[model samples]
Target chain A: MADLALGKESSDFKKGLQAGISIGIGYFPIALTFGLLAKTSGLSIYETVLMSLIVFAGASQYISLSLIAYGTGIFEIILTTFIVNIRHFLMSTSLNEKCEEDQLISKLIYSFGITDETFSVVATKEGTASTGFLFGVISVSYTSWVVFSGVGHLIGANLPQTLQDSMAVALYAMFIGLLVPSMKNNVKVIVLAVFGAIFNSIFTIGHIMAQGWSIVTATLLSAILIESAEVIKAKYRGAGHEK
Target chain B: MRSEIVWMIVGMGLVTYIPRMLPFVLFKGKELPPFIQGVLKNVPYATLGALIFPAIIFIQKDDIWYGILGAAAAFIAAFLGANVIVVVLGSIAVLALYSYLL
Candidate 1:
């Protein structure tokens, strides 16, 4: 029985890695740019690769580059990384529900590999997510991100100074690339983002908080407000449907 | 200065690491309440929006319009559900053109 189970697990891992191929491909460009930007922002090769290896969160790492460029303090960067990656807490919890039981160590190691893309693919796999499968998926995606990041830094090192400077604009465009899809899919998302941006702008203009804090505070406040409105609206919709 | 950079990365790693690992350790078999789940689902959109909007408005200090053009390209590609890499490339292509023409 154990042999059969082990064979099933190994096959699932292979399938998961196969599924993760597209995700690994997807990560390459983003991770590469992150490496390039990290170089532009004055991070050492070790620092750039290490950031991807350790933090492994895309948008937060990009945001940290901007913060570093802005000469923000270390504490603020750490705090921002925390707040930006806060969603992972939720992602892990959700995946835990779908994932089959395994060793605690397996959970510990694989949980670190959870990102938005990995979580989505695993969750939608049309079966109970096995530990072997989850490990397989994360393994490929994590490796692509770390490896491409270094490649990008190397590429960045060779680019002309002029083009390197121009690459700065790509940062904002990248964020928009990540954002607009979600906004189009949901009205509530659009409102939440707009309000958060507006609030962030006010905080920026008012000198109300440091740059990092301003983004953090605006996000928290906007999330609470928009989500409260959503919950209330959902209640009304539920009531109306009942009638 | 470089030492400070290393420490920051390590620090960021810790905070980032904890969140990803904690729930697996703590919430292994338990399901969260529906209300909490709803909030968690909404987090990315909310966070992404806030992160994108005002920052998009201020990209190039001198050439705000330049920033808008790149943003428009990103918006169109992403809204159409182009793959993420395509979305990024679309924006980069537009920006490269905009920079070259101007």
Candidate 2:
């Protein structure tokens, strides 16, 4: 019985590793760009790698670097990171249903690995996601993210001065790349993004608040306002149909 | 400066970890309220928008066009349903070519 169980677990882990290969490949350029940007943002290679190792989330880390570049306050940076990653709360809650029952410690260990990509893969798997399989997928993706980050920083260090300066544009370009797709998919995303951009521009240009605080405030305001507008619109439509 | 960065990273790690972990630890089999879920869903898009603008224009202070052109390239790539990697690399390629011509 024990041997059979062990064999099953190993195979599940192997299957997970196989599933994660594409995610690992997908992380390469993104992580590489992160490392390169971290270098340009004045982070030492050690600091860059440490951020990737500890934080592990791509968009938030990229945002942090930009915040750091702005000389934003540390507390404010933390707050912004929280706001940016709040979506994980929903993802995690939803994923818990698909994951097999496991020990609290095991869940704790694997939950740390629940990135957007990893979560999607595990959640969509045909059956319950095993603890061993979760570990397999996370291990590959996490390793790729951290290792490529270091490599990108090393490459960035050797680039010509002009190229390094041009790299600053890459970060903003990356943000646009991320936002545009979601904006295309949902008009709500379009409204949220446009509102966010307008609010942030006002706060930043007007010097009404520090850059870090501006982002946090703008994000919260846009989300709350747009969501409220959506709720009110739904209510009005419902009333109209009744009449 | 070093210590500040360290503390910042530590704080960030804690905040990031808490959201990802709390649901698994505490929310077992529960769902968030609809309004809250809607707001959370909107946060990423809003944050992304805030992150991009005003900052993009200021990225290349001496050459604002550099920033604008790079953003245009990224927008085009992303609009065409390109993945994040292609969008980034495509913008970088465009900027590199622009710089070469300049």
Candidate 3:
């Protein structure tokens, strides 16, 4: 009995480690960019470290950096990040169901480390997600992000302009890589992407909206519109089937 | 460089903690509503779309054309069943070429 229990524990540990490995691959590049950008944004090494420790969300951190670069107010930056990350509220709503009662403390701890990659991993798990497993996921990811960010910040500060230019292209490439896999599955993703681009262009290029709020507005309005259309489509399909 | 920037970063760090910490405390032992659950199910599609659509049309520094070309190349590459890395590289290649030529 004891050995059986030990076997299961070891297996779950391996599972968590595998999750961490896959997550670390995706996160390392992006977090490296975040660190590099933070340093370039006039933040010191300690400040960049602390920001990664606290914010954890790569997209928001990058956007926040740009906002700061644009001289947006502190309050506005926070507000926009809050809106951008509002999806996490939904992510957490799904996550709460997966955690165990006794493991609430660990859940809270690991929740602090929740990035999109980690959340997607945890959300898809069946049965109780072991604390060991969650931490295993968090530990590897958190360590890699922090370490790479430090490396990037230190190295990035002294790099020549040509090198910075090439390193910067990695981000858009990364975004494309992140997005293309998912877009393959669903047509609606393509539609929303289109609307999001159009909305952003009209608002940003046309000078029709405040720059600080432009992307936020585009994301929110497009999400609502896209999701609403899907709901209506589903309802119509249901009604047609009923008749 | 200034002391105020350090203070500002610290302040932003502090403010971020509220949301990160709040969800754990507020939702302990609670089940989310069904509609909310449904909405959560679709969030990936929503957020991904929201992120991608803007990428194609708007390059920073007010350069929209190159960005749009990049996005279209990405979309076509994606539709052809290319991997994400391939799609991204294709877009970058196309955009870089366009920028150089035009």
After TM-score superposition, what is the CA distance of residue B36 in candidate 1 from its true location, in Å?
A: 1.7
Q: What docking class should model 3 receive?
A: acceptable
* Chain A TM-scores, candidates in order: 0.67, 0.66, 0.63
- TM-scores of the models, in the order given: 0.65, 0.62, 0.64
DockQ of each: 0.48, 0.48, 0.32
lDDT of 3 by residue, A43-91 (tens): 7888788777767777778888898899988778877766656556545
Candidates 2 and 3 compared: the better one by DockQ is 2
Inter-residue clash pairs, candidate 2: none
The collision pairs in model 3 are A193-B53, A197-B53
Q: Kindly list the per-residue Cα lDDT of model 1 for residues A1-243, writing each as its tens digit.
A: 999999998998998887676567657767888998999998988999988998898978999999999999999999988887776776676677778988999888988888767765675465589988998889888999999999999887445533543455454555555566566656777887788788888888788876556665776777778778877877878865642
For candidate 1, state the interface root-mean-square deviation in angstroms to 1 decimal.
4.6
* Chain B TM-score for all candidates, comma-separated: 0.73, 0.70, 0.77
Name the 10 consecutive residues with the lowest summed lDDT in model 2 chain B.
B27-36
Best-to-worst order by lDDT is 2, 1, 3
Full-model lDDT, candidate 2: 0.79
lDDT tens digits, residue span B1-102, model 3? 466655655565555555555666787644666444454444444444444445435453466665666666766776677754465456656766665566
Candidate number of the best TM-score:
1
Candidate 2 residue-wise lDDT, A1-243, digit = tens? 999989888998998887676567657767888999999999999999988988888978999999999999999999998877776665676667667887889888888787766765565466678888998989988999999999999987445646655665655665675567566658888998899899999999999987656777887899889989988888979865642
